[model samples]
Target: MSAITVIINPYANRGDSQHQIDAGLQALATSGLAFDIQLTEYRGHGAELAEAAARNGAEIIVAAGGDGTVHEVANGILRAAEGSEGVASATLGILPVGSGNDFAWGLGLDKGVDLAIDRLRRGQTRIIDVGYVEAEGFPAHYVVNILGGGFDSQVNIEAHKIMRLRGFAIYIVAVLKTLVIYYRNPHATIRFNDETHEFDMLMTFVANGPRLGGGFIAAPHARHDDGLFDICLVHKTTRRDMLLMIPKFMRGAHLNHPKVTMARAARVEIESPEGFPSQADGEIVGNDVRRMVVSLVPQRLRVIV
Candidate 1:
């Protein structure tokens, strides 16, 4: 293995992540590993840096930011290896410095930067699945954790409108506001494998990992290497019913609710009549999506857990 390249997104966590870079460097130094660090100057810079590092013979490319940073880096590495020989694979590592480290939580990489760095230093790797979202008139993209459409996507957009809060608090406020103003269900026609169904759905979550929006375990049975995605559809419900189900999401027992339906599929397509918004890994991608096709990429990346 060659040297590790750590790509830090300085803008993550609303500028609270600068200290994590320092902590990561100190931990790497203590581990006596040969590595180089690069700070991303702008959006999508981490992906470029990771690609360059991999092409230059870097053994590992570490994303030292939040889920967005990790997603970009992973996409870069995968793109770089598209036609390359099998021997030239670059593994991915993560240092969770974002507000909602959803991917990190799935890998059991908690908030401790030093511990995460230590795990990277030890060089343990696991093969994990990745998800790709193909929408009409848009480029295909990857998400490490969860993706959603309809009400959840609206909530993601509204949450970012507030600049002062982070993580669960932002999501909570956004959900409350959206619930009051955006309660109409969108007509969604979904096709999964050999089955087809249509519903008036409040939201649809296609999950590769179990958690999203900080701590909401939206898909309790999702696993990255399962070669399938757990799709959760929340059908239109009364305001009182939705309010009652919100707490069950925290306990990860909402799947048992009658209004919620869960299914596992290798491929799923969703068509909505009202052109709803969509979100992947906490990033909102705009509104009125006519169609979305989600597929799984099995054992796509080597991740340190």
Candidate 2:
């Protein structure tokens, strides 16, 4: 094992993550571990730094922000591993500094700089499954948490415009705001396991881990090491029904509703008549995507739990 590379988004948590970044860096500096830190300045910088560091012999790549930062770092590591042999053996560490540390919560990692460091120092790591997406833009993206299209994507897009709130609160607001104006049930065909299903799909969630948008359990039983995605498909429902189901999502009980169905698959193929927005791990990744392939990458990355 070599030193670590910490990729941080200082503007995470609504630009309130600087304190956590400073504390994490200071702790790493004095921890007697050979390590270097990189602060991301732009949107894709975390991915770039992560890939470079992994290829250059970083043993562990730490993403010290929210799910977006982790998403970029994971994508970077996966890209590098595809070209480099030993790079795939590198582990991933997460310090939950972002507003929605959805992936971190799914991994059972507590939020806060000191707690994250303690878990990292404990040296317990596990090989977990990651989700892979194929679409028009960004040929491939590795998702450590969840990915979604349609209504869920719209909520994330709206959530980004909110600058004052953090965590579950902002997401709650986004959902309400989105329901007021956005309503789209794209004609969708989903195929998995030799079966084809059609729906007027309002939203679809493919989860590697459990949480999406902080605590909304899109797939309540999703597990990262399982090598299969727990899928949540939302069929067309009335505006009143959608509004009433917000609390159900918070409790992860939406699957019991008539409009939602849960399934599992190693590979998922989706085609929709209307191109719509798509997001994964809390970051809006693509727009107007009419076709996509989601597959499970088993034992893709080692993560400290």
Candidate 3:
């Protein structure tokens, strides 16, 4: 037994969250990890719990939910660790008990909850890279996986509404729904890698982890430890072309596509006259963000995967 705190979002999986939390505790008990679980009482509660735990010198904080839960907990831990000694030393652990679990998928932790617990018990740690988004009107924030905009964010917006379904099915339906409703590409200028390029794009992703939307390999070449980010820019395409390329994106074979631009950068700035949808780790950022700069925070997080 070590000093660990489990932050569980009761709303995760869109089902019986209490049952899920209980099951997780049961699993943890068998693993012999002395842990206490805190059920999130409301929105943004995960962050508060995480910050409190980290400030109290907890060694490990487990996000026992989905990507959104992980997002909030990471934000809390990073914020608490800011400008403090030994506070940021808390390593993160994940149990993929949420819809999609995209962050876990990218880290090769999508295997099973038992396996992740086993890894955690072993205390094996990997220090991975992180990202931060700086926008004009929004507070600066850290991102562990992907920070994306344009059509993909729209997909996230639609995907969150399908309460009847969970996981990849919901995303598939959302993708179809967005294709019909959100066909217009936002006009923008992306400045990065010492070059400024302007285009009307369906989406642009500043990727730290490779996969998103459960299985979409948006950045096939991305590595968590790599200081560089794999930036994927999809230029505007016709509706028919978009449909035709869906499978290619699923297989991560779209990198070589003509309309797709694959590049690596440590810093990127984007400006748009009319804002596009923005999302980080499957959560919507701002409704109308005109400008944003995404920069890499190298090896900022220690995780057990």
Per-residue accuracy of model 1 over 1-305 as CA lDDT, tens digit each: 35788888887887777887788888888888888888889877887888888888888999988888888888778767777643238899999988788889988996579889889878888888878789996767777789899888898888878789865798889888888988658888999979987999899999999988777899988998888999999999998898888789877999878999999998889998678889888876567788999888788788887
Question: What TM-score would each prediction reach against the true structure?
Answer: 0.94, 0.96, 0.95
Local accuracy of candidate 3 as per-residue lDDT tens digits, 1-305: 34989988878888545565676678789888788778888877988998889888888999988898898888888888788543258888897778878888888787767777777789888888888889889888888899999999999999888899977888899999999999668888998889988999789999998888877889998988899999999999999999988889899999989999999999999889899889999888876789999988787888887
lDDT tens string, model 2, 102-145?
88888888558888888777779988888878976556788888
What TM-score would candidate 2 get against the native?
Answer: 0.96
Task: Note the residue pairs that clash in candidate 2.
Answer: none
For model 3, the local distance difference test gives 0.86
| Window of ten residues with lowest summed lDDT in model 2 | 82-91
List, in order, the clash count of every candidate structure: 1, 0, 0
